[model samples]
Target: MQIFEAIIGHVEKRCEAKGKRLTTQRKLVLRALIDANQALSAYELVDYCKQYFGETIQAMSVYRILEFLEEVHLVHKLNMSNKYIVCSHIVEGHEQGIPQFLICSKCNKISEKIVAPETITGLQSHARQEGFTVVSPQLEINCVCDKCGQ
Candidate 1:
């Protein structure tokens, strides 16, 4: 299996700094997400772990890990697809702009993009004008990727 030692190390440090423990199963789960080209559901991650590591992981366990990772910003949950993908900015630590996802409906591939501050400000401004509270700044756009489009 491909290894992401650097990313794992960064996550380990981040988890420790946040007073959270990154368990072995959690690390493997993150690695599975990192290795995947598309978003994967918790069940899919269990299958991947069994296939690659010859280890059986329960879907519940994976779900818990995904929750923890999402809480720490090490992963992002795609609500539309019910799948999870690793955060692309993990290696860079904290990022400047909010992260937006371009999800390919055909292939389930997710590409990460940073929404410009101005655009986010505009969105917030519009929401304020409408008297709606901004819960989260993240955005997900549905589209076909180049590979799937062609």
Candidate 2:
């Protein structure tokens, strides 16, 4: 994918398969995720929501929708920041893999990098050996990008 968005063809197939409604609120939330191009806390999402979804939607409503989207693998949440972002690859065709987050500490921009299947498998196996099953490795580190470093 180019970044944070659904390939419309793929998303439509998924929605049909799941029998889920892509309500206006869901579209609004997804748009905000795409536009922000970063992990966004629900509160931040709500701030954007007011513009299109109106003041009627409480934060909890947004959270509920986000929760549903995540459960269905339409979006992924980075627990490190307790924020959500659109998955780079929207389809989880084969019980696939967790998407890794490349987050900028200085500007808070995020880039989703698809971890290789071998890497995820090895990590999961290692975690299982330690009696811990790791779900997200959206690691946050302190560093500046070349532009920021300059």
- Per-residue lDDT tens digits for candidate 1, residues 1-150, read 425987788779988988999999999898888877568999999999999888888999999999999988888888777889888888776743688998878877778988999999999999999999788888999999999989
Error of 1 at 11 (Å): 1.8
lDDT scores of the candidates, listed in order: 0.86, 0.73
- Name the weakest run of 10 consecutive residues (lDDT summed) in model 1: 88-97
Which ranges in model 2 have alpha carbons more than 4 Å from their true place? Answer: 1-10, 52-55, 91-96, 135-143
TM-score of each: 0.86, 0.76
Residue 83 accuracy (lDDT) in model 1: 88
Question: lDDT tens digits, residues 70-116, model 2?
Answer: 87777888776788988766655555355677676788767767678
Q: CA lDDT of 43 in candidate 2?
A: 90
Candidate 2 CA-lDDT value: 0.73
Kindly give the stretch of ten consecutive residues in candidate 2 with the minimal lDDT sum. Answer: 1-10
